[model samples]
Target: MRLSELANPSRFNALAERLLPWLVVATVLAFALGLYQALFVAPDDYQQGATVKIMFIHVPSAWLGMLGWALMAVAALGTLVWRHPLADVAMKTAAPIGAAFTLICLVTGSLWGRPTWGTYWVWDARLTSVLILFLMYLGVIALWRTVEDPSRAARAAAILTLVGAVNLPIIKFSVDWWNTLHQPASVLRLGGSTIYPTILTPLLITAIAFTLLFVTLHLMAMRNEILRRRVRTLRLMRAAAANP
Candidate 1:
């Protein structure tokens, strides 16, 4: 179907429902394979040993945290610039999910660090920037809740989302731009991946699984948002009729 067709809430809802079952199957299969590889097939790190297993989870969470925001940023543009009906829904639904993933990333990163860096927490540039991202997600959620009018809330949140997007680049490049306890990029970089193929393969598979999981969750949230708005509209209508 054409992209514009999804601007219609009903069409979007129908499409989401149709795709959800397939997506769920794909997500489950991907997770099964990824986890099996991560747990049984991949060898432990020479240095970090079994602790390196954390990377399978931590890396995916970190990636999805960033991806959720990036998706929000695009939806924000749709809300403010194009005034697409579903854009706000997309933007709003993404915030809480994104925040959850960001929290996971931070917690796992800290756990990984404790064994490696001999500390649970450090105010490294990369870590600080990701924290800021999580906070921004909270701010956007609060902003939406504070405004009663849907249009007004969408506009306000859109601007906030765009402004918060500045943090994305900062989070990505913080390790490169400053001296930090965090290690440099080992997966995606200028000189290809530094990680060995055996480990890299599972990590990549896990990343794909996490990505599919995110998409499935995001689509489900959007569907819920559409139903919620309809219910809200009906309630307002009934209340107005009773009062009038």
Candidate 2:
């Protein structure tokens, strides 16, 4: 398919239909393998013991929480700068999904922390930044819902999404910049990963599974949005005809 075809709603819908099944299969298989490895194969952390298993879910949730917003930033640029037709759709669909993952990260992090940090919550820079990110996502989603016109809502949400993106970098570096309780990057760094190979392998696999799940859900959501807009357009046309 041509690059421009990606911008066409009907074309995207067709492509998504074909891709969704494969993506679903891949997501399920990856999750199966990842869970097996994380649960049964990978040994517990020497310190955290059984609680270490939470890392499999928490780490992926954290990564995707950031990734979802980063994706919206790119889609926002497409909306404001390039005026791509599917840009707003992509941005809109990703919000709830991202929010969900961020929520998972927070909940799982808190669960992991109670045992590890001796507390369920904290006001550290990293944690606060993530909370802000989650709120920004809700703000963008609310902006879209309040605006009656799709084009206007797209533009408004696009701007908010871009502005909120600054938080992403802050979240990544907060631990290093301050004396935060959160740990810095371990799996990815200037040097090699600090995590044990057995643990790292499952983490990577689970991350892939979550990412695949995101792509599958995002594509499905976009397809639904396209159809919804079509219905709205048709209804507007019908009302205009009746009034005339």
Candidate 3:
């Protein structure tokens, strides 16, 4: 089905229902295989040894962390420009998930850095930018709650999202822009990835799993948002009927 068709809440719910089960199955299988390759099958890094295993989770979480915000920014444009029916819902539901991934990225990065850098934290540009991105996600969620009216809240949140998008490129280019302890892009670069196929394979698989997981959660959240709106409307109608 076309995405435009799914703009209708009923159609969206129907499509989500059909897709959710398959998504769940595929996500589970991908994760299982990805984990197997990351842990047991893939050879340990000659330098980092077992500590390199964390890369499987860390890289994917970090990728999702950035991707979630970009998705929200797109949704924000839809709300501010075309006023797409599902745009606000997409933006709102994405906040918590993005925050979660950002949190994971920070925590895993710290863990990886502890052994490699011999420290738990640093004020490096890349790390700091990612931290700011996490804060931005939380800020958006708070902004949504602070306003009571749906339209007003959506507009406020959309504005904030667009403004926060400036941080994305900063996060991406921070390493190059500053002399940070964090390493430069290895997987995504102008000269192509520097990672060996052995490590790259599991990372790619896990990244796919993470993306599927995000899609599944986003669809479920949107369905719930639709139901909540229906309930609110019903309650208002019942109250009006009783008073009239």
Q: What CA RMSD would candidate 2 show?
A: 0.7
Clashes of 2: 0
lDDT of 3 by residue, 134-157 (tens): 999999999988997778899999
Q: What are the Cα lDDT values of the candidates?
A: 0.94, 0.94, 0.93
| Prediction 3 global C-alpha lDDT | 0.93
Clashing pairs in 2: none
Kindly list the per-residue Cα lDDT of model 2 for residues 63-87, writing each as its tens digit.
9999999999999999999999999
TM-score of each: 0.98, 0.99, 0.97
TM-score of 1: 0.98
lDDT of 1 at 155: 95
For the record, the alpha-carbon RMSD of candidate 3 to the native fold, in angstroms, is 1.0
Clashes of 1: 0
- In candidate 3, the residue pairs with backbone N, CA or C atoms under 3 Å apart (3 or more residues apart, or in different chains) clash, namely none
- Locate the minimum summed-lDDT window of 10 residues in model 1: 182-191
